[model samples]
Target: MKKIVSLYSVAILLIIGSCSTNPFTGKKTLALVSNDQLFPMAFQQYGQFLTENKVVVGTAEAKRVEKVGMKIKAAAERWLTANGQAAVLQGYQWEYKLVDNKEVNAWCMPGGKIVFYTGILPITNDEATMAAVMGHEVAHALASHGAQRMSAGMLQQAGAVAVSVGTQNQSAEKQQMWMQAFGLGSQFGVMLPFSRDHESEADMIGLTLMAVAGYDPKNAVIVWERMSAKGGGQAPPEFMSTHPSNETRIAKITSQIPAAKAEAAKFGVVFK
Candidate 1:
């Protein structure tokens, strides 16, 4: 059974999706989960999330969220068209929502579904900073990180199932051990860290997008600094989780600022 499943997974991965090169980082990417298959599910999930959550409408922050979303969308389209990647974003139907929550969280899902919790608005204090945030979130969708995550999850699940099948007939103690291993391995190895990498990649892409959209890319550095400062009162050590440390993320953004500015020059940005 395990062998059959493994063979099936390999075959499916090989045949279903064509691998593509990432424009931002030039990395090879496997996209087994097509946008056509993933977008509808993401749209449904976004709707469900909004219905379940406290969606704040007709507010300043809500309007800001929409404004930032539009700017980022324009920036994304400009970047794609400039790079001849307009086809990659051809089917995106972008929507951004502001949900009244205090979790200091924001996300963009596949097919351009995005939501910003009101709590994080304070961290993104101004339009420029907010553009940084929106740019980062939108970049995740443009880069297809969600689809990559789903593909990773499928492979992780297949691995867990194989291990379980291999040990199901063993002693009770062995079965318990395998179960724990499966849980830990699936999460830490496949799910958790992958999010952080995608986050960083999105950061790079977002910085450029915001810069091209006429917001200073330096705002990306400021946004991360603000985000880091907010968590200073009580936050996990950056290495303990999936997110990059504020310091590290800020430094990387700073280093990339020159490139972002240079790229924006093609869009008629004047250096101060």
Candidate 2:
């Protein structure tokens, strides 16, 4: 009992000690690895990914990707500066690439390295919807969601360690079984929910960002609607997935459109 209590107490302290505030969200989040440590790694990985993939350059769609990505980055800068938080992006080396793949996916690495898969372009369909998607990816970087996820993973490992230590007195078979159960419980119950929260946060931030970047926040809802309509097959239930369901995402983004417009209004940006 005492060992378990001590282990949990240490885990709590470690989590608290490793937190840093995300300027975009104005929320304290895990920061076990600082940008100082994470960016170089992310940049290198991005370079390797580009080298291994077919990077579509010197094309109209590629140019569109670059143009919209830069605008979204600038919008983030404007918002950060307006809020007196510009320094939060001091270390970001923003790079955008459109990769020729059919994965229907996009991501923003730490320090603002972004990639858009060509497969998703069909779903994006137009420049406005593209900005909505770009904004979401950029928001992931600005919010340090990757770092938060890594930090959460570290805490999950620490909890596993605690469970292991606390159960050391049990038989080996029982111990292994408990560890397996703990792994599943933590992944499904804790980690998946954490990832879904990040996704939702990115969705909200992205809506505001696209609106401030002169894209109608309403297009964000339209983008998701298209994403849903384009039969990507079924996804696991939200409770078992790293992302909220398409329906859930569309609903959440729709509800936040008014708030996003209000935020854009602060920057003297409005939609018709």
Candidate 3:
């Protein structure tokens, strides 16, 4: 009993000591891993991935990716500066690449390394839609979702350890049952919901960034609509998945457009 109490006390101290505020949301977030430690590793891995993959260069499509990415990056800067949070982007080294893979995905790594797979271009169809995707990916990096995820994983592991120690005296069968229940409960109840919240936050931030960059925020909804149709009704339930359902995403984005446009108007961008 004392050992379990000590373990939990340590976990609580760790959580309290390892938190940072999210500049965009002004919310306290876990920061067990700092950007100082995470960015160099991310840059190295990004370099390695680029070397291993077929990176399309000098093509119109590739240039388009770079162009859109730069616009989004600038938009982030503008928003941060306007909000007096320009320091939030310090130490970020932004790079964008288009990979010739057939996966309909794009992602931004820590410190602004970004990749757009060729497979998603068809759905993007135009610069506006592409900006929507780019903005979303960029928002993930800016919001430090990667760092938060790592921190969350560390806490989950700590919880598993606590569970194990708390059940050490139980019978082997009962111990296994307890561990299984912990796994299911933590994954379904905690981790998946945490990820979904990140996705929704990114959606809102990305919409504002794209709007400020002079892209129509409404295209964000359109992009998701196309994405939903492309999925062909195959996504798992929202509670079981890391992303909100497409219908949820579309509705949420639609509702947030007015606010995004208002934000963009601060930078003299007006949408009709």
TM-score of each: 0.88, 0.97, 0.98
TM-score of 2: 0.97
lDDT of all the models against the reference?
0.82, 0.90, 0.93
Candidate 3, residue 126: Cα displacement in angstroms equals 1.2
RMSD of each: 2.7, 1.2, 1.0
For model 3, residues 1-272, the per-residue Cα lDDT tens digits are: 46667898999999999999988899999999999999999999999999999999999999999999999999999999989999999889999899999999999899999999999999887889999999999999989999999999998999889888988998999989988998999999999999999999999999999999999999999899999999999999899999999999999999999999999999999989
> Candidate 1 lDDT, tens digit per residue, 137-249?
99888889988877777766766667777777789899789879778875766577787788889999998888888899888888877877888747666545677778778
Q: Residue 244 in candidate 2 has what lDDT? A: 92
Candidate 1 residues lying further than 4 Å off, grouped into runs, are: 1-18
- What would the C-alpha RMSD of candidate 2 be, to one decimal place? 1.2
